[model samples]
Target: MLLFLLSCFSFIIVFKSSNLYEMVSFLTPKFWIQLFLRPVLKNHASFELSKLDDFEMSLLDLHDLALDQILEQLSPAELCSLAGVCTYLRSKCRSNDMWEKHMEKKWGRIIGNAALREWHWYMANNNKRKYSISGGNNGGSFYSICSWWPLNLVFRPKLQRKSEIKGDLPPDSIMAWYLSLETGEFWFPAQVYNRENGHDGFMLSCYDAKISYNLKTDTFQARYSPHGRRTIEENISWSRLRTPPIDTPPYNLHISDCLDDLRPGDHFEIQWRRNKAYPYGWWYGVIGHLESCSVNEDHCICHDSETVIMEFNQYAPESRWRRKKVSRKDHREEGNEADGFYGGIRKLYSKQEISMWKSLWPTKVLN
Candidate 1:
């Protein structure tokens, strides 16, 4: 018992050492809880919680109300440490409300329905694999279990992972998912601005990719789709990425809601693609008046007309890439194979969005 007590004392020192703890996550709260229990812990861990005697400087020594307040202020690492002390603390730490806050603070910007669906697939597949390895009960087929999950998500009000609940932790819990992301085990689908590692061709635009965190470098890796070729980019920072602001898929045109507000010199992004086989990418453009419209500011009736001209100044004057016209009242897919196709148009509202595009202006005009 003396040796156990001494070991606990030494562990408290290591736990308090922030640098050491981060360097080795395995030395975290879970590790501390299991350190004393050894081979017998799993069976008796919950029972032993009642037997623990709080000592000096231990948060465990505080009243439940006071401890609860302190827990609210603690960061993720601190919560993890406190959780391993006892079953009651573990319950509080693993609560969905707490994990959800952390998730939003860090990942809410870039994670949307698609990312959530992908996470579900990851959890279901992982559970299925574990079941196969362990000879699961009932022995259901993988396809039968997860085939309709994405569709079912639409009608369901809340996400439930009852099937994935097993062992000490539920794989489907928000806490588990957050930890998976923190550890870089999960690569979620999201969009990155100026992708292709800031290639000039993709500047002022965003593209879809499967992105994952890199703990060592505090960066990210993005895996692009393989229509004809596949590529992966590394060391991408957070500022370059964002959740798709709109739900429209890359191939489908984003239904324009702000077209009625288009005016001369107003900035906008129109979906454009080289061919039907390619996905639509948001290209920066400006709304202009028709040749027949009066140049006088007061006499301009361009916005009221059926046709709205979109100009890309980055292209040479004689280049086919310079200008295109779409119906203001009803504009669908417009363009041919020679000049590429143009889809829906979205008026740029935020000054920041406009500034970001201006900053990426090509040094030379496109032919």
Candidate 2:
């Protein structure tokens, strides 16, 4: 009995020396509760609640909100701010479904589908349809239009005063999305598509629209020419590598830049620009959707200039092109020299114009 008592005393001393009781405390619920809740609870009170004004309170009311709820409840400006907070929020903010929902809200289902289809066709041809759309222009995703654009835009609801024309160009067409290509900034270029009834004089007037992404300039500029670059031999001549004719007329023209209003969901506008000061008071117009800059190279796609090719036909080369031309006398013995002449005529006219006949045409077209 005394030996057992001595053993018990030795065990107690070893346990006390090792502090095993302290270690076991970690297994208790109180210790776990302290460890688990302390960081969140202690930091919670220190959070600056007073800084959250009424604006943020209403937004936070959407805490734990679903995608649809956030899009439907918040304004675009608000959603932009929220998405900018973190990666998790950014991912949730740029959902295509949200854009489509807004699309449907702004335009009817039929119009929305038509617009989306048009956008799809544009992007598909330009190799961009596979990427996200809304985020591409909203300064969120890759090659965005709004990010890094150099501009100080003031959003005015009503016209405080008439827009002072900035350049000698005509009054501004509606400003579509613009870009700062020199700096990879996006701006609102003028858009001018209108409805007018005519058949002979102006029935078929075509407005040419193009968007160029210039890496050096880091800006994207959109242009609209109701009649396209004028055919003054000067313009065409200068377009080529060769020097233009001395008689080439100067292309003295003007454009407009005026956009002062901003609506909640207004993507861009389509308006008109009349160059009354021109030689004939011409009207230049265009319609544009969006512009995306290349992340690596200087490139962009204008919606109107793109086309989707559903099918491409291929053909194999033929050796018939290698046949030697026969002399008139040498062909007479073969009987149909006249036939050879006509055949040569047809082939020369048709095949000579083919892409392979580069040698026959002047390397310098304008010069």
Candidate 3:
């Protein structure tokens, strides 16, 4: 009797499990999930119990858990990791709101249009400054210094009449000029009486000087012209001056023929065969530290690979001339033509049109 009863109980257990499986198979997936999974997954304590009663309960619980805390504090490196792990987070990482927040919070406040650009990568270690002079009379603007140092320089001007033009000075006659460190103003009260000729032929003089700006050469070259006698081309005491030219050309015959004399903001004119014509091209003065030099046909070729070449302006309307200024450094940089020469040329051409436009219309209303 006992053996017969045990067999019957085993048969009943198997029959009940078979019926449950068939019922679940007949129901839609949504009904099955609603009747069985949702409540257990939302409550972890209940999920463990349902795991014993239902097979799909554990998977639902894990899916809900993944949508919790971990997504909040994601770094760029972390987001990239998420992209590798699964497809869902990859799409989430690319949301525009996330990127803008990353830029704003992780970065500092915006300074200006220029400040927003990644200019730090291109900037050299040298000190640079930007200045502007306004408010004295006619809206004439004075230039600002561009160095990485602090300066309080004042300008004084000495004017001399051009020798060839012989007549009463026209009210608008702008004579020769000079600047003084003693006074902080650019003055043109008296005629420059030094031996140097104002016009017609080349003339030379030696006096303490600071090159404010070189429009032609686009360089900022300065020197102390001592109180000494020197002819324009004849007595260009290359030794007395801080910098002397290493080479000479017929055009620079009256001046020191030192291409090596280039400084940060000097300017010069060059004759280039462009469009089948020897058009006088302008090259801004820049001495990218002499990275390296090689003797080719008895000429030492040096380069300014890292130096920035401002837009090449020839007879640019805004400034009569564009040019260079001088500073001092003992060590020379190395030469890599691809890195320096072409880079400068590229920079020059990249914004050449915009610069030309600004010059052509300094005060036009932009639409």
Candidate 4:
């Protein structure tokens, strides 16, 4: 490492090129570790170091667009380190278009359309508060800024420019939104696997919750409604969250169109609740072979049947929780309050979804 640093300085002496040396000097040790040592050592590829023929060849010599393309190769942490090099690089590293891909890659699985709506609402609300409308007295039309409702007959004058929102988190940049999410400033609605803090009763189940990041522990905290005798949950790790397959609300039943297409061994999640007063939770299960049907798919006609057999393999063989039969044509929140009503059903078409649930399989069977 010492020799490497000295050789970098030799660039300035040999070619009188300060740009290369300055850029190298500005990079943090963290960036060096992650960008160089970790990747090279892990990959174990034999890469030959190329010699620089021209003294004028430096990162500063590249076109701004070309430089941006190069910087885009860095991870978010590396980008942060690159940002600290200077003001020009800082602006480049903080590009909204750049951070968008990173944000989506990291958060797309766990945050669905509802969470997106929440994010837009959060940003719009913040933007409304941060910027003052110059036409405050124009027929009280300024009220639309706060409400964000449609402006009817009132003409929206061109917004007067104001100073950018003061703080590390500016609403205009996607990076700020990413930071807000990381810092838990914005709470989003998503489903949590085995919710209610992994209570045994919730094993293999997912429930609706308003989630916020816990940066200190690198976990998450979920706020569930005060229904079904379970409420707040904390210390939710990343693996326990997923974007809802459909943007269905907890109270409303999900309309199922895949009923006629159901087959044995197919995976699915169906809504269930003990009573009408309680919100529904999604329980993972699989379609089971009907008792009279043969195992062969060639002879199988289960899909044509009006009734579908649902099996919960997590439960013991004799457990009443093991099996449920719901009618396809008449399937609309079937079951008495004593047995707990089953609501809408969503088919698991994504292999990732099935694999995620399988990853969470319990070590022991439930009673």
Best by lDDT: 4
In candidate 1, position 180 carries an lDDT of: 70
What is the C-alpha local distance difference test score of candidate 2? 0.27
Q: Which stretches of candidate 3 lie over 4 Å from their true place?
A: 1-70, 86-88, 110-113, 117-367
Evaluated against the true structure, the overall lDDT of model 3 is 0.27
TM-score of 1: 0.70
TM-score of each: 0.70, 0.24, 0.17, 0.71
Residues 102-193, candidate 4, lDDT per residue (tens digit)?
89898877877898888888888777543221112221321222222111001122322222211133566776666567657678999899
RMSD of 1: 12.9
Candidate scoring better on TM-score of 1 and 2 = 1
Note the Cα lDDT for every prediction shown: 0.68, 0.27, 0.27, 0.70
Ranking by TM-score: 4, 1, 2, 3
Of candidates 4 and 2, the better by lDDT: 4
Task: For residues 1-367, write the lDDT of model 3, one tens digit per residue.
Answer: 8975775566457546654335223222334445555666767753564443444332123343343223334553333333222223334543444444444442222112222221232122212421111111221221111110111000002212222111111111111011111012221111111113222111111122322223333222332233224322222221222211112211221222333444333333222111221111122222232324342424433334323222233323354223222212321222232322110111122254334323332232111
Error of 3 at 172 (Å): 53
Compose the digit string of candidate 2's lDDT tens values, residues 1-367. 9985785577567557864446334322344434555566667867553333222222223345433453445544343433333334444545554444443442231132223343345434544222221233324432332111111011112212221211111111101111111122232121111112121222212122233333433333444344433321111110111111111111222221212221111121111123322121122112222224232223434222332111001111232211222232222111132222111111112332232222222222111
Candidate 2 off by > 4 Å: 1-71, 105-115, 125-367
Candidate 3 or 1, higher TM-score? 1
Residue 184: error of model 2 in Å?
Answer: 14
Q: Sort by lDDT, best first: what order?
A: 4, 1, 2, 3
